[model samples]
Target: MRIVIALGGNAMTAPDGGARVEDQLAAIGAAAEPIADLVLAGHEVLLTHGNGPQVGNLLRKNELAATVVPPIPLDWCDASTQATIGVTILDALDDALGARGSDRRTTVLVSRTLVDRDDPGFAHPTKPIGRYLTRDEAEPLIDHGQEFVEIAGRGWRRVVASPEPRECLDAAAADTLLAAGYVVVCSGGGGIPTQRTADGRLEGVEAVIDKDLTAALVAGHIGADLLVIATDVATVIRGYQTPTQQPIGTLTAPAMRELAAREAFAAGSMGPKVEAITRFAERGGIGVITSLDRITDAVTGTAGTRVVPAG
Candidate 1:
Protein backbone atom coordinates (compact mmCIF):
# COMPACT_ATOMS: atom_id res chain seq x y z
CA MET A 1 0.00 0.00 0.00
CA ARG A 2 1.08 3.56 -0.54
CA ILE A 3 1.49 5.08 2.93
CA VAL A 4 2.05 8.57 4.25
CA ILE A 5 3.27 8.70 7.88
CA ALA A 6 3.27 11.96 9.82
CA LEU A 7 5.62 11.92 12.79
CA GLY A 8 5.07 14.30 15.64
CA GLY A 9 7.84 16.65 16.82
CA ASN A 10 7.93 14.92 20.18
CA ALA A 11 9.26 11.84 18.41
CA MET A 12 12.44 13.77 17.62
CA THR A 13 12.98 15.45 20.98
CA ALA A 14 13.74 14.44 24.56
CA PRO A 15 10.90 14.37 27.03
CA ASP A 16 12.17 17.60 28.54
CA GLY A 17 12.36 19.14 25.06
CA GLY A 18 16.13 19.19 24.65
CA ALA A 19 17.24 20.40 21.19
CA ARG A 20 20.80 19.12 21.09
CA VAL A 21 21.73 17.88 17.62
CA GLU A 22 23.10 14.50 18.72
CA ASP A 23 20.15 13.76 20.99
CA GLN A 24 17.66 14.68 18.31
CA LEU A 25 19.40 12.44 15.80
CA ALA A 26 19.34 9.60 18.30
CA ALA A 27 15.63 10.08 18.82
CA ILE A 28 14.96 10.04 15.08
CA GLY A 29 17.15 6.98 14.70
CA ALA A 30 14.86 5.12 17.08
CA ALA A 31 11.75 6.28 15.25
CA ALA A 32 13.18 5.25 11.88
CA GLU A 33 13.28 1.57 12.74
CA PRO A 34 9.55 0.95 12.39
CA ILE A 35 9.46 3.02 9.20
CA ALA A 36 12.28 0.95 7.72
CA ASP A 37 10.36 -2.19 8.56
CA LEU A 38 7.42 -0.90 6.57
CA VAL A 39 9.65 -0.22 3.58
CA LEU A 40 11.15 -3.70 3.82
CA ALA A 41 7.66 -5.17 3.92
CA GLY A 42 7.02 -3.75 0.41
CA HIS A 43 4.88 -0.72 1.26
CA GLU A 44 5.78 2.54 -0.50
CA VAL A 45 6.30 5.12 2.23
CA LEU A 46 6.33 8.91 2.36
CA LEU A 47 7.50 10.57 5.57
CA THR A 48 6.80 13.98 7.12
CA HIS A 49 7.61 15.31 10.60
CA GLY A 50 6.77 18.21 12.91
CA ASN A 51 9.30 20.92 13.87
CA GLY A 52 7.85 22.54 16.98
CA PRO A 53 10.89 22.06 19.22
CA GLN A 54 13.49 22.70 16.56
CA VAL A 55 11.85 25.85 15.21
CA GLY A 56 11.24 27.09 18.70
CA ASN A 57 14.93 26.66 19.45
CA LEU A 58 15.80 28.63 16.33
CA LEU A 59 13.40 31.40 17.33
CA ARG A 60 15.04 31.53 20.73
CA LYS A 61 18.46 31.92 19.09
CA ASN A 62 17.13 34.71 16.91
CA GLU A 63 15.91 36.56 19.95
CA LEU A 64 19.24 36.14 21.73
CA ALA A 65 21.16 37.63 18.78
CA ALA A 66 18.59 40.21 17.68
CA THR A 67 20.91 43.10 18.67
CA VAL A 68 23.94 41.53 17.01
CA VAL A 69 22.12 40.55 13.79
CA PRO A 70 18.71 40.64 12.19
CA PRO A 71 16.32 37.95 13.29
CA ILE A 72 15.11 35.41 10.77
CA PRO A 73 11.43 35.48 9.85
CA LEU A 74 9.12 32.66 10.90
CA ASP A 75 8.88 31.34 7.33
CA TRP A 76 12.64 31.15 7.09
CA CYS A 77 12.73 29.45 10.45
CA ASP A 78 10.25 26.88 9.12
CA ALA A 79 12.45 26.27 6.07
CA SER A 80 15.56 26.05 8.21
CA THR A 81 14.05 23.50 10.60
CA GLN A 82 12.69 21.45 7.70
CA ALA A 83 16.16 21.05 6.27
CA THR A 84 17.68 20.33 9.63
CA ILE A 85 15.14 17.65 10.54
CA GLY A 86 14.91 16.30 6.98
CA VAL A 87 18.61 15.58 6.70
CA THR A 88 18.65 13.96 10.10
CA ILE A 89 15.73 11.71 9.13
CA LEU A 90 17.44 10.84 5.85
CA ASP A 91 20.58 9.77 7.68
CA ALA A 92 18.73 7.76 10.31
CA LEU A 93 16.47 5.99 7.83
CA ASP A 94 19.46 5.18 5.66
CA ASP A 95 21.21 3.53 8.58
CA ALA A 96 18.09 1.64 9.63
CA LEU A 97 17.47 0.27 6.15
CA GLY A 98 21.11 -0.67 5.78
CA ALA A 99 21.12 -2.55 9.06
CA ARG A 100 18.15 -4.54 7.80
CA GLY A 101 20.13 -5.37 4.58
CA SER A 102 17.96 -3.27 2.30
CA ASP A 103 19.54 -0.99 -0.29
CA ARG A 104 16.47 1.25 -0.59
CA ARG A 105 17.14 4.96 -1.13
CA THR A 106 15.63 7.90 0.77
CA THR A 107 15.38 11.58 -0.13
CA VAL A 108 14.04 14.88 1.19
CA LEU A 109 12.17 17.57 -0.75
CA VAL A 110 11.88 20.96 0.92
CA SER A 111 8.25 21.53 0.01
CA ARG A 112 5.89 24.53 -0.08
CA THR A 113 2.22 24.51 1.02
CA LEU A 114 -0.16 27.17 -0.26
CA VAL A 115 -2.37 29.06 2.22
CA ASP A 116 -4.71 31.97 1.89
CA ARG A 117 -3.43 35.36 3.01
CA ASP A 118 -6.87 36.12 4.43
CA ASP A 119 -7.11 32.88 6.40
CA PRO A 120 -8.96 33.46 9.67
CA GLY A 121 -6.05 31.71 11.38
CA PHE A 122 -3.90 34.73 10.61
CA ALA A 123 -6.29 37.02 12.44
CA HIS A 124 -6.36 34.67 15.41
CA PRO A 125 -2.98 33.16 16.21
CA THR A 126 -3.56 30.21 18.53
CA LYS A 127 -0.74 27.72 17.95
CA PRO A 128 1.79 27.94 20.73
CA ILE A 129 5.56 27.72 20.21
CA GLY A 130 8.81 28.22 22.12
CA ARG A 131 9.66 27.65 25.76
CA TYR A 132 7.64 28.94 28.63
CA LEU A 133 8.64 32.34 29.93
CA THR A 134 7.81 34.36 33.00
CA ARG A 135 5.43 37.28 32.65
CA ASP A 136 8.27 39.74 33.25
CA GLU A 137 10.25 38.31 30.35
CA ALA A 138 7.18 38.14 28.12
CA GLU A 139 6.16 41.77 28.60
CA PRO A 140 8.74 43.22 26.19
CA LEU A 141 7.78 40.70 23.48
CA ILE A 142 4.11 41.49 24.04
CA ASP A 143 4.96 45.18 23.66
CA HIS A 144 6.58 44.38 20.31
CA GLY A 145 3.26 42.95 19.04
CA GLN A 146 3.95 39.32 19.86
CA GLU A 147 1.06 37.41 21.39
CA PHE A 148 1.40 35.29 24.50
CA VAL A 149 -0.99 33.18 26.52
CA GLU A 150 -0.37 31.88 29.99
CA ILE A 151 -0.76 28.12 30.22
CA ALA A 152 -2.38 27.91 33.62
CA GLY A 153 0.58 27.28 35.94
CA ARG A 154 3.11 26.64 33.21
CA GLY A 155 3.86 30.30 32.47
CA TRP A 156 3.58 32.14 29.12
CA ARG A 157 4.28 30.92 25.56
CA ARG A 158 4.46 32.63 22.19
CA VAL A 159 1.67 31.80 19.76
CA VAL A 160 1.53 31.93 15.96
CA ALA A 161 -1.19 31.53 13.35
CA SER A 162 -1.70 27.96 12.20
CA PRO A 163 -3.20 28.48 8.77
CA GLU A 164 -4.87 25.67 6.91
CA PRO A 165 -2.93 24.24 3.97
CA ARG A 166 -4.63 24.53 0.61
CA GLU A 167 -2.12 22.52 -1.39
CA CYS A 168 1.24 20.81 -1.28
CA LEU A 169 3.17 22.36 -4.17
CA ASP A 170 5.71 19.53 -4.42
CA ALA A 171 3.32 16.60 -4.30
CA ALA A 172 4.24 15.66 -7.86
CA ALA A 173 7.88 15.33 -6.94
CA ALA A 174 6.93 13.14 -3.99
CA ASP A 175 4.79 10.97 -6.21
CA THR A 176 7.63 10.53 -8.67
CA LEU A 177 10.00 9.59 -5.89
CA LEU A 178 7.51 7.08 -4.45
CA ALA A 179 7.04 5.51 -7.87
CA ALA A 180 10.79 5.12 -8.16
CA GLY A 181 10.80 3.17 -4.83
CA TYR A 182 12.44 5.95 -2.86
CA VAL A 183 11.35 6.60 0.74
CA VAL A 184 10.42 10.25 0.32
CA VAL A 185 10.44 12.84 3.11
CA CYS A 186 8.71 16.10 2.40
CA SER A 187 6.38 18.77 3.83
CA GLY A 188 8.12 19.15 7.16
CA GLY A 189 6.75 21.92 9.34
CA GLY A 190 3.70 22.04 7.08
CA GLY A 191 5.78 22.93 3.99
CA ILE A 192 6.84 26.43 4.96
CA PRO A 193 3.49 28.25 4.67
CA THR A 194 3.36 30.05 1.28
CA GLN A 195 1.06 32.28 -0.77
CA ARG A 196 0.91 33.82 -4.23
CA THR A 197 1.58 37.48 -4.88
CA ALA A 198 -0.53 39.73 -7.11
CA ASP A 199 2.12 39.26 -9.81
CA GLY A 200 1.88 35.47 -9.38
CA ARG A 201 5.13 35.06 -7.50
CA LEU A 202 5.24 32.67 -4.56
CA GLU A 203 6.03 34.26 -1.20
CA GLY A 204 6.50 32.71 2.23
CA VAL A 205 4.09 33.72 4.95
CA GLU A 206 4.87 34.38 8.60
CA ALA A 207 2.79 31.51 9.94
CA VAL A 208 2.81 27.79 10.61
CA ILE A 209 0.50 25.15 9.19
CA ASP A 210 -0.64 22.11 11.13
CA LYS A 211 1.36 19.11 9.89
CA ASP A 212 -1.45 16.49 10.20
CA LEU A 213 -3.76 18.61 8.03
CA THR A 214 -0.97 19.05 5.50
CA ALA A 215 -0.32 15.31 5.60
CA ALA A 216 -3.94 14.63 4.69
CA LEU A 217 -3.65 17.10 1.79
CA VAL A 218 -0.46 15.47 0.54
CA ALA A 219 -1.97 11.99 0.90
CA GLY A 220 -4.88 12.92 -1.36
CA HIS A 221 -2.62 14.75 -3.81
CA ILE A 222 -0.29 11.76 -4.14
CA GLY A 223 -3.07 9.17 -4.14
CA ALA A 224 -1.99 7.44 -0.98
CA ASP A 225 -3.99 4.37 0.08
CA LEU A 226 -3.24 4.83 3.75
CA LEU A 227 -2.44 7.79 5.98
CA VAL A 228 -0.77 7.09 9.34
CA ILE A 229 -0.54 9.89 11.89
CA ALA A 230 2.01 8.82 14.53
CA THR A 231 1.68 10.56 17.85
CA ASP A 232 2.81 9.74 21.41
CA VAL A 233 -0.39 7.84 22.13
CA ALA A 234 -1.02 4.26 21.12
CA THR A 235 -4.65 4.93 20.23
CA VAL A 236 -7.34 7.60 20.36
CA ILE A 237 -9.19 7.46 23.66
CA ARG A 238 -12.93 8.00 23.84
CA GLY A 239 -12.94 9.70 27.24
CA TYR A 240 -9.33 10.76 27.76
CA GLN A 241 -8.09 11.41 31.30
CA THR A 242 -11.29 10.23 32.86
CA PRO A 243 -12.35 7.04 34.64
CA THR A 244 -14.38 5.99 31.60
CA GLN A 245 -11.51 6.58 29.19
CA GLN A 246 -11.39 3.81 26.62
CA PRO A 247 -9.38 3.13 23.47
CA ILE A 248 -11.21 3.59 20.19
CA GLY A 249 -10.75 0.83 17.66
CA THR A 250 -12.29 1.15 14.21
CA LEU A 251 -14.57 4.10 13.47
CA THR A 252 -16.48 5.05 10.35
CA ALA A 253 -15.85 8.51 8.92
CA PRO A 254 -19.35 9.69 9.73
CA ALA A 255 -19.17 8.36 13.27
CA MET A 256 -15.85 10.10 13.86
CA ARG A 257 -17.25 13.33 12.45
CA GLU A 258 -20.20 13.12 14.84
CA LEU A 259 -17.82 12.71 17.77
CA ALA A 260 -15.75 15.61 16.50
CA ALA A 261 -18.83 17.79 16.26
CA ARG A 262 -19.51 17.07 19.92
CA GLU A 263 -15.97 18.16 20.79
CA ALA A 264 -15.12 14.77 22.23
CA PHE A 265 -11.43 15.41 21.79
CA ALA A 266 -9.13 18.11 23.10
CA ALA A 267 -8.78 20.96 20.63
CA GLY A 268 -5.03 21.38 21.00
CA SER A 269 -4.23 17.71 20.80
CA MET A 270 -6.33 14.93 19.33
CA GLY A 271 -8.88 17.18 17.61
CA PRO A 272 -6.72 18.05 14.60
CA LYS A 273 -5.54 14.46 14.28
CA VAL A 274 -9.06 13.05 14.28
CA GLU A 275 -10.15 15.72 11.83
CA ALA A 276 -7.28 14.91 9.48
CA ILE A 277 -7.98 11.19 9.53
CA THR A 278 -11.69 11.76 9.00
CA ARG A 279 -10.91 13.90 5.97
CA PHE A 280 -8.75 11.17 4.52
CA ALA A 281 -11.34 8.52 5.26
CA GLU A 282 -14.05 10.57 3.62
CA ARG A 283 -11.90 10.58 0.48
CA GLY A 284 -11.91 6.74 0.49
CA GLY A 285 -8.56 6.12 2.13
CA ILE A 286 -7.86 4.36 5.42
CA GLY A 287 -6.34 6.45 8.19
CA VAL A 288 -4.60 5.22 11.34
CA ILE A 289 -3.75 7.02 14.53
CA THR A 290 -1.10 5.30 16.63
CA SER A 291 2.32 5.63 18.14
CA LEU A 292 5.40 5.10 15.97
CA ASP A 293 6.08 1.67 17.41
CA ARG A 294 2.71 0.32 16.29
CA ILE A 295 2.78 1.51 12.70
CA THR A 296 3.14 -1.95 11.18
CA ASP A 297 0.41 -3.29 13.43
CA ALA A 298 -1.81 -0.36 12.62
CA VAL A 299 -1.42 -1.01 8.93
CA THR A 300 -2.31 -4.65 9.42
CA GLY A 301 -5.50 -3.65 11.33
CA THR A 302 -4.40 -5.24 14.59
CA ALA A 303 -3.77 -1.99 16.43
CA GLY A 304 -4.41 1.76 16.52
CA THR A 305 -7.55 3.75 15.83
CA ARG A 306 -8.50 3.06 12.23
CA VAL A 307 -10.84 5.38 10.35
CA VAL A 308 -12.63 4.04 7.29
CA PRO A 309 -15.16 5.45 4.88
CA ALA A 310 -18.78 5.17 5.95
CA GLY A 311 -20.85 2.70 3.98
Candidate 2:
Protein backbone atom coordinates (compact mmCIF):
# COMPACT_ATOMS: atom_id res chain seq x y z
CA MET A 1 0.00 0.00 0.00
CA ARG A 2 1.12 3.56 -0.64
CA ILE A 3 1.08 5.38 2.70
CA VAL A 4 1.68 8.89 3.94
CA ILE A 5 2.68 9.34 7.59
CA ALA A 6 2.51 12.68 9.41
CA LEU A 7 4.73 12.82 12.47
CA GLY A 8 3.99 15.42 15.09
CA GLY A 9 6.66 18.02 15.84
CA ASN A 10 6.39 17.43 19.57
CA ALA A 11 7.68 13.94 18.90
CA MET A 12 10.82 15.47 17.38
CA THR A 13 11.79 17.29 20.59
CA ALA A 14 12.25 16.33 24.21
CA PRO A 15 9.25 16.32 26.53
CA ASP A 16 10.82 19.22 28.41
CA GLY A 17 11.46 21.15 25.16
CA GLY A 18 15.14 20.34 24.81
CA ALA A 19 16.28 21.15 21.23
CA ARG A 20 19.77 19.65 21.39
CA VAL A 21 20.81 18.15 18.05
CA GLU A 22 21.89 14.85 19.58
CA ASP A 23 18.65 14.44 21.53
CA GLN A 24 16.47 15.21 18.49
CA LEU A 25 18.42 12.79 16.33
CA ALA A 26 17.82 10.13 18.97
CA ALA A 27 14.11 10.89 19.06
CA ILE A 28 13.85 10.68 15.28
CA GLY A 29 15.96 7.52 15.24
CA ALA A 30 13.47 5.81 17.50
CA ALA A 31 10.57 7.14 15.44
CA ALA A 32 12.14 6.01 12.19
CA GLU A 33 12.20 2.30 13.09
CA PRO A 34 8.49 1.67 12.64
CA ILE A 35 8.51 3.61 9.38
CA ALA A 36 11.50 1.65 8.18
CA ASP A 37 9.71 -1.56 9.10
CA LEU A 38 6.81 -0.54 6.86
CA VAL A 39 9.14 0.07 3.99
CA LEU A 40 10.88 -3.26 4.55
CA ALA A 41 7.47 -4.91 4.58
CA GLY A 42 7.00 -3.62 0.99
CA HIS A 43 4.76 -0.62 1.52
CA GLU A 44 5.72 2.56 -0.32
CA VAL A 45 5.79 5.42 2.20
CA LEU A 46 5.92 9.20 2.13
CA LEU A 47 6.66 11.13 5.32
CA THR A 48 5.98 14.65 6.60
CA HIS A 49 6.53 16.20 10.04
CA GLY A 50 5.42 19.16 12.10
CA ASN A 51 7.86 21.95 13.01
CA GLY A 52 6.22 23.67 15.98
CA PRO A 53 9.07 23.28 18.44
CA GLN A 54 11.87 23.56 15.89
CA VAL A 55 10.52 26.68 14.22
CA GLY A 56 9.63 28.17 17.57
CA ASN A 57 13.20 27.69 18.67
CA LEU A 58 14.39 29.44 15.52
CA LEU A 59 11.99 32.33 16.11
CA ARG A 60 13.25 32.63 19.66
CA LYS A 61 16.81 32.68 18.41
CA ASN A 62 15.93 35.39 15.92
CA GLU A 63 14.53 37.53 18.72
CA LEU A 64 17.55 36.99 20.96
CA ALA A 65 20.00 37.84 18.17
CA ALA A 66 18.06 40.81 16.78
CA THR A 67 20.56 43.34 18.16
CA VAL A 68 23.60 41.56 16.74
CA VAL A 69 22.08 40.37 13.41
CA PRO A 70 18.95 40.96 11.40
CA PRO A 71 16.13 38.59 12.25
CA ILE A 72 14.72 36.51 9.40
CA PRO A 73 11.06 36.37 8.42
CA LEU A 74 8.69 33.62 9.52
CA ASP A 75 8.79 32.02 6.06
CA TRP A 76 12.59 31.86 6.26
CA CYS A 77 12.35 30.28 9.68
CA ASP A 78 9.91 27.73 8.21
CA ALA A 79 12.34 26.88 5.41
CA SER A 80 15.27 26.61 7.84
CA THR A 81 13.43 24.27 10.19
CA GLN A 82 12.25 22.14 7.24
CA ALA A 83 15.84 21.64 6.11
CA THR A 84 17.10 21.12 9.65
CA ILE A 85 14.41 18.60 10.59
CA GLY A 86 14.40 17.05 7.12
CA VAL A 87 18.12 16.27 7.39
CA THR A 88 17.62 14.84 10.86
CA ILE A 89 14.79 12.62 9.64
CA LEU A 90 16.79 11.48 6.62
CA ASP A 91 19.83 10.57 8.75
CA ALA A 92 17.79 8.65 11.28
CA LEU A 93 15.72 6.82 8.65
CA ASP A 94 18.88 5.90 6.72
CA ASP A 95 20.45 4.49 9.86
CA ALA A 96 17.31 2.59 10.74
CA LEU A 97 17.07 1.11 7.24
CA GLY A 98 20.75 0.17 7.31
CA ALA A 99 20.48 -1.49 10.75
CA ARG A 100 17.60 -3.57 9.40
CA GLY A 101 19.81 -4.57 6.42
CA SER A 102 17.58 -2.89 3.86
CA ASP A 103 19.03 -1.03 0.90
CA ARG A 104 16.10 1.39 0.62
CA ARG A 105 17.17 5.08 0.73
CA THR A 106 15.43 8.25 1.97
CA THR A 107 15.37 11.84 0.74
CA VAL A 108 13.88 15.26 1.59
CA LEU A 109 12.25 17.83 -0.69
CA VAL A 110 12.05 21.45 0.43
CA SER A 111 8.37 21.86 -0.40
CA ARG A 112 6.15 24.93 -0.50
CA THR A 113 2.38 25.16 0.13
CA LEU A 114 0.18 27.74 -1.55
CA VAL A 115 -2.24 29.87 0.47
CA ASP A 116 -4.45 32.81 -0.29
CA ARG A 117 -3.06 36.26 0.37
CA ASP A 118 -6.38 37.57 1.67
CA ASP A 119 -6.91 34.62 3.97
CA PRO A 120 -8.66 35.70 7.17
CA GLY A 121 -5.93 33.89 9.03
CA PHE A 122 -3.58 36.68 8.08
CA ALA A 123 -5.70 39.21 9.98
CA HIS A 124 -5.98 36.90 12.97
CA PRO A 125 -2.89 34.95 13.91
CA THR A 126 -3.84 31.98 16.11
CA LYS A 127 -0.97 29.54 15.65
CA PRO A 128 1.34 29.61 18.69
CA ILE A 129 5.14 29.54 18.35
CA GLY A 130 8.04 30.02 20.73
CA ARG A 131 8.34 29.22 24.44
CA TYR A 132 6.08 30.61 27.07
CA LEU A 133 6.84 34.07 28.43
CA THR A 134 5.55 36.11 31.33
CA ARG A 135 3.15 38.97 30.57
CA ASP A 136 5.88 41.48 31.37
CA GLU A 137 8.18 39.85 28.85
CA ALA A 138 5.40 39.66 26.24
CA GLU A 139 4.44 43.31 26.65
CA PRO A 140 7.34 44.64 24.59
CA LEU A 141 6.58 42.34 21.66
CA ILE A 142 2.87 43.03 21.82
CA ASP A 143 3.54 46.76 21.81
CA HIS A 144 5.73 46.35 18.77
CA GLY A 145 2.91 44.85 16.61
CA GLN A 146 3.55 41.20 17.46
CA GLU A 147 0.69 39.04 18.70
CA PHE A 148 0.80 37.00 21.89
CA VAL A 149 -1.74 34.76 23.50
CA GLU A 150 -1.91 33.56 27.10
CA ILE A 151 -2.59 29.86 27.42
CA ALA A 152 -3.99 29.73 30.93
CA GLY A 153 -1.16 28.28 33.02
CA ARG A 154 1.26 28.11 30.11
CA GLY A 155 1.82 31.89 30.09
CA TRP A 156 2.11 33.88 26.88
CA ARG A 157 3.62 32.88 23.52
CA ARG A 158 3.71 34.47 20.13
CA VAL A 159 0.96 33.53 17.65
CA VAL A 160 0.97 33.65 13.83
CA ALA A 161 -1.50 33.09 11.05
CA SER A 162 -2.24 29.46 10.23
CA PRO A 163 -3.70 29.77 6.75
CA GLU A 164 -5.32 26.93 4.88
CA PRO A 165 -3.11 25.12 2.37
CA ARG A 166 -4.42 25.25 -1.20
CA GLU A 167 -1.74 23.47 -3.18
CA CYS A 168 1.59 21.76 -2.77
CA LEU A 169 4.13 23.03 -5.30
CA ASP A 170 6.44 20.01 -5.13
CA ALA A 171 4.02 17.12 -4.94
CA ALA A 172 5.11 15.87 -8.37
CA ALA A 173 8.69 15.56 -7.22
CA ALA A 174 7.59 13.76 -4.08
CA ASP A 175 5.48 11.38 -6.14
CA THR A 176 8.43 10.69 -8.40
CA LEU A 177 10.63 9.83 -5.43
CA LEU A 178 7.99 7.49 -4.06
CA ALA A 179 7.73 5.87 -7.45
CA ALA A 180 11.48 5.26 -7.41
CA GLY A 181 11.18 3.41 -4.05
CA TYR A 182 12.61 6.27 -1.99
CA VAL A 183 11.06 6.92 1.43
CA VAL A 184 10.35 10.59 0.74
CA VAL A 185 9.91 13.29 3.42
CA CYS A 186 8.52 16.61 2.37
CA SER A 187 6.00 19.34 3.34
CA GLY A 188 7.59 19.97 6.75
CA GLY A 189 5.80 22.70 8.71
CA GLY A 190 3.16 22.76 5.98
CA GLY A 191 5.65 23.37 3.19
CA ILE A 192 6.93 26.82 4.11
CA PRO A 193 3.61 28.68 3.57
CA THR A 194 3.76 30.44 0.18
CA GLN A 195 1.44 32.38 -2.11
CA ARG A 196 1.45 33.63 -5.71
CA THR A 197 1.82 37.17 -6.95
CA ALA A 198 -0.35 38.88 -9.55
CA ASP A 199 2.41 38.34 -12.07
CA GLY A 200 2.39 34.60 -11.26
CA ARG A 201 5.57 34.63 -9.19
CA LEU A 202 5.68 32.51 -6.02
CA GLU A 203 6.30 34.39 -2.78
CA GLY A 204 6.71 33.14 0.76
CA VAL A 205 4.15 34.34 3.25
CA GLU A 206 4.42 35.08 6.97
CA ALA A 207 2.28 32.18 8.13
CA VAL A 208 2.25 28.53 9.00
CA ILE A 209 -0.02 25.94 7.40
CA ASP A 210 -1.27 23.07 9.50
CA LYS A 211 0.87 20.05 8.66
CA ASP A 212 -2.00 17.54 8.91
CA LEU A 213 -4.02 19.32 6.21
CA THR A 214 -0.98 19.57 4.00
CA ALA A 215 -0.34 15.87 4.52
CA ALA A 216 -3.81 15.07 3.22
CA LEU A 217 -3.22 17.31 0.23
CA VAL A 218 0.05 15.58 -0.53
CA ALA A 219 -1.52 12.15 -0.03
CA GLY A 220 -4.17 12.98 -2.61
CA HIS A 221 -1.59 14.41 -4.98
CA ILE A 222 0.60 11.33 -4.74
CA GLY A 223 -2.35 8.88 -4.81
CA ALA A 224 -1.63 7.38 -1.42
CA ASP A 225 -3.86 4.49 -0.37
CA LEU A 226 -3.42 5.18 3.33
CA LEU A 227 -2.86 8.33 5.38
CA VAL A 228 -1.53 7.91 8.90
CA ILE A 229 -1.24 10.79 11.33
CA ALA A 230 1.08 9.94 14.21
CA THR A 231 0.41 11.92 17.34
CA ASP A 232 1.30 11.46 21.05
CA VAL A 233 -1.96 9.61 21.75
CA ALA A 234 -2.58 5.99 20.91
CA THR A 235 -6.13 6.65 19.68
CA VAL A 236 -8.75 9.30 19.33
CA ILE A 237 -10.86 9.47 22.48
CA ARG A 238 -14.41 10.72 22.65
CA GLY A 239 -15.18 12.98 25.64
CA TYR A 240 -11.46 13.10 26.34
CA GLN A 241 -10.29 13.44 29.97
CA THR A 242 -13.82 12.89 31.27
CA PRO A 243 -15.24 9.84 33.01
CA THR A 244 -17.32 9.21 29.88
CA GLN A 245 -14.25 9.22 27.68
CA GLN A 246 -14.15 6.31 25.27
CA PRO A 247 -11.57 5.30 22.68
CA ILE A 248 -12.87 5.29 19.12
CA GLY A 249 -12.09 2.40 16.84
CA THR A 250 -13.08 2.09 13.18
CA LEU A 251 -15.36 4.87 11.99
CA THR A 252 -16.71 5.96 8.64
CA ALA A 253 -16.05 9.45 7.32
CA PRO A 254 -19.67 10.48 7.82
CA ALA A 255 -19.67 9.27 11.41
CA MET A 256 -16.47 11.11 12.21
CA ARG A 257 -17.79 14.25 10.55
CA GLU A 258 -20.90 14.06 12.72
CA LEU A 259 -18.81 13.84 15.85
CA ALA A 260 -16.62 16.68 14.68
CA ALA A 261 -19.68 18.81 13.95
CA ARG A 262 -20.67 18.43 17.58
CA GLU A 263 -17.29 19.81 18.55
CA ALA A 264 -16.22 16.52 20.05
CA PHE A 265 -12.55 17.45 19.68
CA ALA A 266 -10.52 20.45 20.72
CA ALA A 267 -9.81 22.82 17.83
CA GLY A 268 -6.19 23.33 18.79
CA SER A 269 -5.44 19.63 19.13
CA MET A 270 -7.29 16.67 17.64
CA GLY A 271 -9.71 18.82 15.70
CA PRO A 272 -7.47 19.49 12.73
CA LYS A 273 -6.27 15.92 12.73
CA VAL A 274 -9.80 14.57 12.59
CA GLU A 275 -10.65 17.00 9.83
CA ALA A 276 -7.59 15.99 7.83
CA ILE A 277 -8.34 12.30 8.08
CA THR A 278 -12.01 12.76 7.34
CA ARG A 279 -11.19 14.79 4.27
CA PHE A 280 -8.95 12.03 3.02
CA ALA A 281 -11.52 9.38 3.82
CA GLU A 282 -14.10 11.35 1.92
CA ARG A 283 -11.86 11.07 -1.08
CA GLY A 284 -11.91 7.23 -0.78
CA GLY A 285 -8.61 6.68 1.02
CA ILE A 286 -8.11 5.08 4.43
CA GLY A 287 -6.99 7.31 7.30
CA VAL A 288 -5.61 6.34 10.69
CA ILE A 289 -4.76 8.24 13.84
CA THR A 290 -2.45 6.60 16.34
CA SER A 291 0.80 6.99 18.24
CA LEU A 292 4.19 6.77 16.54
CA ASP A 293 4.76 3.26 17.86
CA ARG A 294 1.52 1.89 16.40
CA ILE A 295 1.86 3.08 12.80
CA THR A 296 2.31 -0.43 11.45
CA ASP A 297 -0.68 -1.71 13.39
CA ALA A 298 -2.76 1.22 12.29
CA VAL A 299 -2.02 0.39 8.68
CA THR A 300 -3.29 -3.17 9.20
CA GLY A 301 -6.42 -1.89 10.98
CA THR A 302 -5.49 -3.65 14.20
CA ALA A 303 -4.79 -0.43 16.10
CA GLY A 304 -5.58 3.30 15.99
CA THR A 305 -8.84 5.05 15.17
CA ARG A 306 -9.39 4.17 11.53
CA VAL A 307 -11.51 6.30 9.22
CA VAL A 308 -12.95 4.94 6.03
CA PRO A 309 -15.26 6.40 3.45
CA ALA A 310 -18.95 5.99 4.11
CA GLY A 311 -20.78 3.41 2.02
Lowest-sum lDDT 10-residue window in model 2? 62-71
lDDT of 1 by residue, 37-144 (tens): 999999999999899888888878865665566667788998998888999999999999999999999999999999987899889998888778888767766665
* Regions of model 2 farther than 4 Å from truth: 132-157
Count clashing residue pairs in model 2. Answer: 0
Question: What is the lDDT for 40 in model 1?
Answer: 97
lDDT of 2 by residue, 34-97 (tens): 9989999999999999988787778777667655666678899889889999999999889989
| Model 1 stretches astray by more than 4 angstroms | 132-157
TM-score of 1: 0.93
True-structure lDDT of candidate 2? 0.89
Listed in order, each prediction's TM-score against the native is 0.93, 0.93
Clashes of 1: 0
Q: Cα deviation in Å at residue 224, candidate 2? A: 0.4
State the RMSD for candidate 2: 2.2
